[model samples]
Target: MSSIDSQTTYLKYREYSDLLKVILYSSQSVLGAVPLIYHLKHNNQNIIFIQTGTMGGNVIHYLISNGPPSKKFIELKRLTGDYTFVDKIGTDGMSLYIPILELEKSNLDFP
Candidate 1:
């Protein structure tokens, strides 16, 4: 590929990475692990901590099930699908205060 083509590809990949980061952060916010202020200013969304799902399913399921007060529990289930692998963040006893540089090298990867 030409240099221009490679540069275009790299830029597109970067955009996708950024989009993924937004999605991850937003989901984390829904779990009340982190605030969404970094992503959105003047945000008025009520935050709710996802309770431990000892029953079954993943963390996403837990959040959807126990979403904010305005949205009914049943409504959440109707709006979301099953997330097979995700679970509650920091449930593994990991420290949230780990430095930003260390986060990139975090061994938080799951199967």
Candidate 2:
């Protein structure tokens, strides 16, 4: 896993956290009855935000059964073919906070 400059990232994101919170909360309200913001935590030491999969299962259930199907979700469902190993993809539910410096080193083109 790539190490992140937590301080830099925190500083960059801190100014927008309130705006993000408002957008997220509003979206959650629109979603209605879905588990969206499942326990948000921030580490004072690292200044990194962490959100655990407390109600992730509920969210998945809501998305699969009740929520409006998105194009990506439909594609993912088709690719996984029964939701068996869907969780095994990528970091397997683990979130990675990569620094901008590290992202710049990659071949991916982003602004």
Candidate 3:
């Protein structure tokens, strides 16, 4: 691995459980997704996702991480309802929409 990749993984995912915290709280912000992208860009491991109390009060299962960067995702951006694209947005202000499938799936952790 390159030194940059090593540094990114070391800092972003030092604790496996912290991924949960970051997803649940900060997924919509640069702080959360940047580290997540860094980690995914460098690592092949996937994160387990567990959900309880669904439509029928059942449990659902999925994996919540990716292998590497895809070209489409690299060019993706969040946009407002008015179609204003943004890279970084505030946590509690106007919502920024991300349309990429993987990122939308990652947002399911926000609970």
Candidate 4:
């Protein structure tokens, strides 16, 4: 693994269980998926990882994830309301939405 990978992989994940609320991955980054899964899992931080894009969820689940977060979630209920293609969005506001199939399967320890 590269130095960057090694660094993130070794961080304390349990501490981030409820703190790390967002993870927005772009298709451009090569080591964006499993490496993150390995890092998060290795540290014991079970997360409701919001995956987006065409191949984003596929990439992560294939690598470090034991399985996806559960599928029994309602889309925050309120977040489902209609909005323009580009509305209430900011640099850190939006994230890739994970499918219900993936979310419903994992036994995550979310807060």
Candidates in order have lDDT scores of 0.23, 0.22, 0.33, 0.29
* Ranking of models by lDDT: 3, 4, 1, 2
lDDT (10s digit) by residue, model 4, range 8-78: 22122332222122232232257554122222342453433432234222212222335334333222112
TM-score of every candidate: 0.17, 0.17, 0.21, 0.21
Candidate 1 wrong stretches, greater than 4 Å: 1-14, 31-111
Residue-level lDDT tens digits of model 2 in 1-111: 123222112112342233234323433464432122111112212122212123222111100112211221111122222222121234433221111110112221111
State the displacement of the C-alpha of residue 4, model 3, in Å, after optimal TM-score superposition.
2.1
lDDT for residue 51 in candidate 2, whole number 0-100:
22
Error of 2 at 49 (Å): 2.0
Q: lDDT of candidate 4?
A: 0.29
Write model 1 residue lDDT over 34-98, tens digit each, in one string: 31111111123222222122233223111111223321221111123212222222333222211
Give candidate 1's whole-model lDDT. Answer: 0.23
Worst 10 residues of 3 by lDDT: 34-43
For candidate 2, the TM-score is 0.17
Position 86, candidate 3: lDDT: 40
Q: State how far residue 48 of model 4 sits from its true place (Å).
A: 1.5
Model 2 segments beyond 4 Å from truth? 2-12, 16-29, 33-111
Question: What order do candidates take by TM-score, descending?
Answer: 4, 3, 2, 1
Q: Give the TM-score of candidate 1.
A: 0.17
lDDT: worst 10-residue window of model 4: 76-85
